[model samples]
Target: MISVGVDVGNKFTKAVVLKDGQVISKSIVLSGFDQKQSANEAYDQAIKEAGISKNDVNYVLATGAGKKEVDFANDVVSEVGAGARGAVYFFPSGRTIIDVGAEDGRASKCDQNGKIVDFAVNEKCAAGAGSFSESMARALEVPLEEIGPLALQSNNVIYMNAQCTVFAESEVVSLIHAKTSKADISKAVHDAIAARIISMARRVGVEKDLVMIGGVGNNVGFLKALGDGLEIEVLVPDKPEYVCAIGAALIAAERN
Candidate 1:
């Protein structure tokens, strides 16, 4: 059986095609101003990559912040539920999941079977999410993709005190004006976010085989900071940002 999953996130839409319990293809695109359009584009792209026609899909499931906007989906799943299932699929031994998306961050404790036990989230602000780093990179006049590598070059760990995105912007500017090294500033920004993420994860109770997912998981510097802050090895899957969509596709397979 072939199944498709769509995840409409705040900043990006992700699609996955699963066949016979394996992910055959996936696609990601900026959400832009039209969520539905982006979802369709992602789904269509994945189908094309898999060399499958739309009619070939047996089921379609949608997940994420904008999941409800995907009118064509057969059903929808909570982002947290999808994330937990997807992460477990990649790391079967994982019991704790840390997902840092564009707009928010989540920490979930799950069973060996990928069932959620408890969870905590930091959604009130962007300070603990990917947007924070993106904004910081912009302030430093560096590409977001380069921020992680630049941070890795830091010989000293500068401390960032701002806990709010708006305030952090000013702090970053001040640091820049003070002639702070970009590498140190980058490390500071990620460290601040890491501290917040670790706190949220701890509330849900951290356990062995911790996994990190979502777009921010692509940031090696952030991952390193998170690992150090939590004092645990962070396991990440390939294309970690697509994990939620992958989970939704897996769910579609199960229902079929």
Candidate 2:
């Protein structure tokens, strides 16, 4: 069966095309003002890459913050469910899942079969999501892609006390005025975000074989901080941002 999945997230929209159980093509596009347009663009790109027409697809599923905006989807799944299913597809041993995107962070405890047992979410807070790192990177005059690697070079442990993104930006400015190294400040930013994620994960009862999937999973500094804070290795699948889309496609195949 050929199935397609479109995930319309806050920052980006992703689409994946799968043939039977294997991924054939995937696409990602910035989610601008119109989520529906973004979703359609991503889906079109994926279909083109896969050399298939919309008529060839057997099912189309949507998931993520803007899932409801996908008017063409045959069905919709919650982010938690899609995330858990995707994580398990990559690592059957993954029982605890953490997904951190542009605007929210979530943790879920799932069984071996990808059935969610418990879950927790940190939403509507920039401080608990990737936007916090983006804001801090901007304040430090560092490129978003370089900030993660820069944080890994710091040996000093600097703590950031501010919990709000607005206050945290000011704190970053203060650190700069105090002649704090950019690396140290970067580390502090990652540590702060990791702390919040760890706290949320704890609420759902963290377990071994933990997996992290989302756009933020690509941030090495944040990944290191999260692992260190949790005292456990966090597994990340290739192209982590597409996991939810892939999961949605898998579900489409299963449902049909």
Candidate 3:
């Protein structure tokens, strides 16, 4: 069966094409003012990469913050549901799933079949999400892609007390004024976000075989901090940002 999944997130839109439950092609694009347009653009890019036509697809599913904006989707799934399903698809033993997106962070505990048992969300603030890192990186005058590696180079244990992104940015500025090294500030930013995410995960009862999915999953610094905070290794699948789209495609295949 050929299925397609489109995830319209806060910062980006992703699409994945699958054949018989295996990923064939995927695309990611910035989510502009028009979410529907971005979704279609991503889907078209994926279909083109797969060398397939829209007519050949069996089903199209949508998931993410702007999922409802995907008017072309045949069905829709919640972000938590898609995250759990995708995580389990990558690691069958994944019972604890953590997804840190651009605007929010979520932790879900699921059964063997990817059915959610309990979940917790840090939705009120961006301090625990990818945008926080971007803001901090900007404050540190470092490139966004370089922040993770920079953080990894530091061994200092500097703590950030701000829970709000605005305050966090100010705190970063203060640290700079204090003559703190950029590496230490970078590490502190990642550590603070990881700590908040871990606290939320604990509310959902974190278990073995923990999986992290989302754009932030690609951040090596955040990954290390998260694993250290939880005292467990965090598993991240290839193209972690596209996990939700893959899950939606899988769901489309299963539903049909």
Candidate 4:
């Protein structure tokens, strides 16, 4: 039997196909407002890669903000559960997961077997997210990928007085005018993001083998900051951005 799981994250839709409890194929597809179309494309790509027909995918699970857009899904699940499951799958010793996406971030504590025991989330702020960094990059004329690596090279002062996204952007501009290198300003931005993620991690009580997932995990600077603030090394999945989809696939395996 084959099962398909897809995570419709704010910026991307990720799909994973599992056969007899092992992942056989996966796809990360760019998302659109008509979420259903994006989900279908994700599944199409997964099926094509697996050399299977749509009918061969016995069950489908969906999670994340745009999950409902997965018209063919058999179950619509919570992102927290998916993250927890995905974390344990990657690091069997994982006890905590900090997932930062485009609009929100959260922390979850799970048992050794990966069942969520407690969780905390921040849906009201965009301070420590991938979107915030992307916005800063665009305003600063710096590429997103270079934000972290370059930020590490700066020796200037860190400046971000407020955690609000609007205020932070304005502050970034002020720093720029003060002759601060984009790298320094970027590092401060990531420091702010790390603080937010650490705050969330503390809410759930930080634990060993901590896993960081979602789009933000792809940012080296932010992850490094997270590792620094939490005082516990964080484990990044081989595909940091696909942890949610991988977790969904694990859930599908459990169902079977």
Candidate 5:
């Protein structure tokens, strides 16, 4: 059976094609103003890349914040549910799934079968999510991709006191004016975000085989900070951001 999964996120759209429980193709694109349009484009791109006709797809499952916008989807799955299913695909032993998206973060507890048992989310604030780092990177006048390596060079421990994104941006600016090194400020930003996410995850009870899947999972600095905060080695899939889409596709395949 062949299936497709579309993850319509706040800032991006991801799609994956799954055939017989294996991923055949995946695509990612900026969400832009029209989420539905972006989702369709991502799906089309995935099918094209897989060298298959759209008519060959058995089912289409949608997940993420904008899942409802995917008008063509046969079914919808919650982000946490998708994350649990997706993380387990990469690490069969994964018991804790951490997902940090553009504007929110979620932690899901999963059983051996990748079914969600419990979950927690930090959706009301951006301080614990990917946006925090993007905003902080802007304040430091550094490219988002460069922040990771720069943060790894930090030699001093600097703590950020703000928990609100607006306040955090102000704090970052102040640090810039105070002659603080960019590396130290960057590390502080990642550490602060990591601390908030870790606290949220602990409430749901973190377990062994911790796995992280999201756009922020690709950030080396953030990953290091999160792993250190949890005092465990965090596992991230090769395509961390596409995990949700992969899970949705798997669900579609199962439904078939």
Candidate 6:
């Protein structure tokens, strides 16, 4: 039996195909202006990779901020639950999960089975979120892929104290005008975001084996800062961003 999971995130659309509880294939594509098209593209690519047909997929579970746009989905799961479930599926021992996505940031506490017991989320602003970081990369005239590594090279970073993305833009611009190094500025951005996520984790009683999930989890620089703040080793999945879609597919299998 095959199950499909689609995650329509703000920045991208991801899809995964599962056989039993294992992910056979997955794809991620930029969301573009047309979210529906993006979701379809992701689904198509995943099916191609899995060597399966649309009819072969027993169920399609949707998740993420824009799951409703995926017309083909059988059901939609909460992003919070999806992230927590995904993290635990990828790292079964993970007690805490910090998920930073394009639209928002979230923290969740889960049991041994990866079932979420509590969570917190910030949807009002982009501060400390993926979109904010992407915007910073644009303002700094650097690629998103380079921001993390360059951030690690900074000697000292000037803190971005504000949580508002608009205000942070003005602050970053002022820093640039003052000739602040890009490395330091990038480090500061990661630190600023880590602070926000840490608060959410602490409130939920962050435990050992904390894992960082979501697309933001791939940022090695951000993970370093988060580790320092939490004073613990952060467990990251081999394919961090794909975890949600993978989890959704696994959950879909249960229904089938």
Q: Which candidate achieves the best TM-score against the true structure?
A: 2
Q: Residue by residue across 1-256, what tens digits does model 4's lDDT show?
A: 7888899988899999988878889998888677889999999999999989988877899998899888899998899999889888889999998999988898999998889999998877788777888888877889888887876776555758978888888888888999887888988988888888888789789888898888888888887778877778889888777888888887886676
Candidate 3: which stretches are off by over 4 Å?
Answer: none
RMSD of every prediction = 1.0, 0.6, 0.8, 1.3, 0.9, 1.4
Cα lDDT listed for each candidate: 0.92, 0.95, 0.94, 0.86, 0.92, 0.87
Report the poorest 10 consecutive residues by lDDT, candidate 3. Answer: 120-129
Q: How many clashes does each candidate structure show, in the order listed?
A: 0, 0, 0, 0, 0, 0
Model 3 reaches what TM-score against the true structure? Answer: 0.98
Candidate 5: worst 10 consecutive residues by lDDT?
A: 148-157
Candidate 5 residue-wise lDDT, 111-165, digit = tens? 9878999999887888999999999999999999989788889857898989898
**What lDDT is reached at residue 53 by model 6?**
90
| lDDT of each residue in 165-212, candidate 2, tens digit only | 999999999999999999999999999999999999999999999999
Poorest lDDT segment (10 consecutive residues) of candidate 2: 121-130
TM-score of 1: 0.98
Model 6: per-residue Cα lDDT over 190-250, one tens digit each: 8888888898789888898898888998888789889998999999998788888877887
Clashing pairs in 6: none
- Can you write out model 1's per-residue Cα lDDT over 1-256, one digit (the tens) per residue? 9999899999999999999989999999999989989989998899999999999999999998899888889999988888999999999999999999999899999998788999998777899999999999989999999999999998687888788988998999999999999999999999999999999998999999999999999999899999998899999999899999998898889988
What lDDT score is found at residue 170 in candidate 3?
Answer: 95
TM-score-superior candidate, 2 or 6: 2
Error of model 3, residue 48, in angstroms: 1.0
Off by over 4 Å in 4: 155-159
| Best of the two (1, 4) by lDDT | 1
Best by lDDT: 2
